[model samples]
Target: MYYAEGTHEPIIAPATFEQAKERLRKIAQQTANRKKPSRSAFSGLIRCGIICGDCGAFFGSKVWNSTSKYRRVIWRCNNKFKGEHKCETPHLYEETIKTRFVGAFNAILADKDSALENCRLMQSTLTDCSGLDAEIKSLLEEIDVVTELTKRCIAENSQTAQNQEEYAARYNGFVERYEKAKTRVEELHSIKNVRQAQADAIGAFMFEVQELDTLSEFDNKLWLTVIDTVTVHADGRMTFKFQGSTVIDA
Candidate 1:
């Protein structure tokens, strides 16, 4: 095939295109070689993706028999009996977790439209950084002015015969103001980043929700994409934390 570049401009930048290709490659690998799910399914599924309500420890998976027909997967809190204060959280079977997920996920689907609306509103609110950007701009201007003033003060001090203490005081004052403005800019940036992350999560959740009205059976890829964590309590209470921080009890 001959090189056939599009007439229009490229849709994505080179770096972003490369990153997308890499991501797809990784996903392909994970799907192709699926086998015994890892015990520490941190970014995978409910093996270590669960949190214990009692001990606040992560859950780990175990196989009852390694080489037998009676092998069964069980999940329990890692610190269930580690210390004097033992965790009372009950061990859960893999099937139990899967069944619970189906129920909870179906519940979410029942309210899919309303949840999408709420998530859209939240994403809009969180992603709008106009106010913070304005403040950052103002602070940058102040920093620039202070920086120039400090330079002028130093220059004047060098050229003219000024009182040492007075000159030092003025120079330090400008420096302190500049530093304070810089620190405030950094703080604003930090806040913006955190909010933006939340917005992204909400957007992702909304997108996934929009794709399906109901799931006939559990799809591993979709489950991992939408679910963040599962928390189980001592009294057999379970909570599913979905992407975008949406929580549901099952």
Candidate 2:
């Protein structure tokens, strides 16, 4: 293969070309080592997150050699030939799987307008977190009040000689209230973080969509950023799940 510096405009940017070269180099290394099985081109391009929906096992890649012209790469359930009961999932060719992904992704792009609008609608509720902010503020105030009460109780116990049993009870009550309030605050913060993450994920999807008119070929960078999971089932079916929870099937 020859790569010459082109005078005409390049189809891919220089950085993208370098990234593709790196990916190819890594995948070449993976395929060279057959002693300990590594991933195939599909898994390498998409990362190691493919799942077998039938046996709930991870997928593995394999290469079959007949001749130089007839050599092929395929993927199958890792546990298919391991145990008494074999997984029923079918082996998939590398090109077929990649093509299916392109179809699934392009299907989403086909409805890009509606999908962006839907994301915006969902973001309206997820990003508008004034209610959660107010609740967090109220929780923080309660925590502060409980902390002050605990401090006051400890100070009283240290200053005045009181009944040991009564003083212990009062201090314990304040301590328990303070801990409960702190726990509540932590829970509320966790809820807020989840909402923020959802909003951010939707925003990212919208941003990527805005830059695309249509995809004529497979985009490695876009695939990595936009896809979350690719699942294959026993019934010769494939599903692509995007980052923002968009699912397409092949």
Candidate of highest lDDT = 1
For model 1, name the residue pairs that clash: none
| Tens digits of per-residue lDDT for model 1, 1-250 | 1111222477785335655675799788678647645543333455547999997999887778868888777888989989899999999986677778878888888999777777777788888889998998888888878877887898899899999999999988988898788889878877876786567667767887888887776667677677778999989988999876678998
What would the TM-score be for candidate 2 when compared with the true structure? 0.70
lDDT by residue for model 2 (1-250), tens: 1111223587886435655675698678767744555445355554366788888787777778846777777788888898899888898887777788778877888899888888788788876768866876776676667667767877888999889899889878867776676676667656766776667667777788778777677766677667777888888899888767788898
Q: What is the lDDT of residue 147 in candidate 2?
A: 69
**In order, what lDDT does every prediction score?**
0.78, 0.73
Lowest summed lDDT over 10 consecutive residues: which window, candidate 1? 1-10
> Lowest summed-lDDT stretch of 10 residues in model 2?
1-10
TM-score of 1: 0.73
